[model samples]
Target: MCWKTLLCCSLWLLLLKSNENLAFKIPSIDFEMLHELGFEVSIPDEPGMQRVFYMLQIDDNCPALMDYITESNNGSWISRQKTSLQNNDKLQISVLVQYNDEIYEKSETRVIINARLLTTRDGRSQSITYPNGEGECHAYLSPQKQAKRCKPAQSIVSSSRQTCQGELLFEDNFSEAQLNRSTWKHDIRQRMYHVEEELVAFDDAPRNSYVKEGYLHIVPIVASEVVEGSFKLGDRCTAVESPEQECNIAQGSFYSIKPPVFSAQIHTRDSFSFKYGKIVVRAKLPKGDWLFPYVMLQPVSTYAETHYAKQLRVAYARGNSHLQSNQQEDISGSHLYGGMVVWPHGRAMQYLKDRLSKAHYGDSFHNYTMIWQRDKITLMVDEEIYGELYEGLSFFNEKCFIIFGVTVGGFLNFDDSVLAKDVKPYLNREPRAALSFWQQRDTWAPTWGKHSSMIIDYVRVYAE
Candidate 1:
């Protein structure tokens, strides 16, 4: 019986000692360390900040509190890293507490100075609490720099007007002396193959097709020299190749390298391709008649026949147009072929020609844009929605990049008299009588030049 009583007494003593040694939790910030650390604080509603406040319970074995300051790289400001120190110079936080003939101690707040950039683990530029209940009250450094959604999207107005102001995945500035030597490639082959090359030649034509003020101007040269060369594999033009065939040509233009060959079709296919987003190009239109203005957006999928070009003819033939008659120049059904001739086959091309004939083109520099969502593809010229293809079109099943270029004449014929007169002297031609009748005629005046050039100002793309 006495042994049992002694055992219970010893157990009670051990419990008392255990309770005495155990430490308790403490608050984050202490009043005394604020001056040394040089911290500024403000409460949401209060005039000043709270220096000390009892939060939850504390831990026992933690050492005393110490505070230290770390300034920014430019020495603009100072913030606290550690706020507690004990006899051993060990860092910790201590909370004040009182009990009858006893006092408990534990590090209160774990101060962090010189924190990494705003991250999930580090709380942020403002106050944060750790999963373990330790915390630091950091003052709000700066208001977040918000980004404005593009017009018509109803997004917040952000300060970024320049192209560099958004989430940019890739950017290449072509400041190199020889732009062709940089991120560009050419397809010298004689067939229509989409070459996965980035470096594009806009007016790789003769001296008349030079890039000035960021726009590639395609003008005529009357020196019997054919303006036929283009970046990669493309046709050229010459005066002799004019449709009239009556004028002994001084110079003719052609993309003669090959039809459907990888001409100046620059793309980010193998290197990079985006999923869903918008691309905005601030540019002006290329002038001159017989000009073929085009932008190509092609989407590829691992599921489709990668090597073979999906016959858009078959796709569009599902409509009223038959495939055989569709191929002819004067056929009414030939309207869809305009979309098919470009390298990257898709609806973006189909809508562009219709958009160009609208009132907004040629007169001003406008934003030629493409908005690709999961369900729809929209083509816009100057903020006006020209065409929209629903998700039903198979070409838009995958994401794509932007490709743009201009040609003197390929499949479409603009035999307008004003255009012909403007073009006649450069390549000696028979002056036609009826300008309006020629303009209405449907004939493909293929530019027979070897090298030609197209121009652009700036290209920008954005993602969510």
Candidate 2:
């Protein structure tokens, strides 16, 4: 062959070699069959294929439940975690075929999982698709047994000292359209739960909390956004994760690994700090399963002040507790026991002594008052004493500020067994079931409605 012919022949051979190297077929994924069979599938073994895997993307509406799907092995796709899919949820499945550690071809499919099949009928049985594609199967879900409400115990009075009628040091009636930034610090941090063991996202946004109708309404609603990091600080404040640093007004920092349900938390840490006084909060608490209402005081030193003296923190919590036999006792429209905790010493002083009341505080407005003096700390509900500690007077000398908010599931009081049986099915894999279940309740609008709030009529501090 001539030089020109030889060059043309070489180019043709190179083209053939390139075509052979690029020769790969996209793997066909049976998504419809996979969805029907519960999203578990076995991929056919292909020669020269080094590895195979799948990626799942949930529809935008149900994006929070996207982490449920995972790859099990080189040839299978499996959902290792428990999840709930809502009606009309679209799941996008992408299958990647690789050879020599390089991606050869990718096949993708989107499928809708019917949610009606997951809803329980009479809170017991649910219809689900069988994995073998034989037919639908009915599974019985464990019933959520309601706990009996405790009978109202005899009211207990700790000290003969009458309710504090001292001169008012400060008060917030919440009469304005917006929160008073001068008096209250809106510590809008993302997923920072260091203060309490609860599932709640604290944000500065008005939707999570607001002042309206002459009431400071701190509402816990469904989360619209996900935030991850340490606490977000206010003006002239920096985030501190260690106790070595001296922060005059510090908010504890916590790392949240997953998306959380958003709520609101505000404090007087920077704005107001008092040594000893009478603090009274008149408010109506939120009612529903797994909700926690809190009015607390933390040392301005953020526990670091204990080096000078043991720092003190006092709080009032209600809704769920280990002292009570049934964690859901408060949500059954029955008795409400306001719990008091005084830490570094984790003590439930009220319930331990059986001095609680049976009043459903969620049904109406009630007063939660704390009297702190040099020698004693007392907690009362509606002017009736529930708990008191007389010996921890030295710690009470430290200046502490107030924090008001509500929270859901967390290490503090969440019971996973109860959750899986009673609330998990309805949660649909959403992380914050308390907020989700409360928003979906039929009585939410009629009974709670816009009033689904920790309505603070007034927060007053009285000094000697």
Best by lDDT: 2
lDDT of 2 by residue, 211-235 (tens): 8889888877754433333233344
Candidate 1 per-residue lDDT, tens place, 1-464, comes to 22123224542232233336334322233322231122232112111211221222112222211222222223222223322211122122322222232333333233333111111122212211343335432221122221222222211112323332124444433333333323332211221122211111223333533345445443332222123433232243111222222111122232112122112334444444555555665544433333444444445343111233321211110111111222233311222211322235532233222332323133345666665555665656555565665634555445454444443332222322323233221221222212221232233122223222344555655543
Candidate 2 lDDT trough over 10 residues, lowest sum: 120-129
TM-score (all chains, Cα) for each model? 0.38, 0.47
Question: Which residue runs does candidate 1 get wrong by more than 4 Å?
Answer: 1-166, 171-181, 187-265, 300-360, 412-453
- Against the true structure, what is every candidate's RMSD? 19.0, 27.4
TM-score of 2: 0.47
Clashes of 2: 0
Instruction: Report the backbone clash tally of model 1.
Output: 64
Q: Find the 10 residues in a row with the least total lDDT in model 1.
A: 314-323
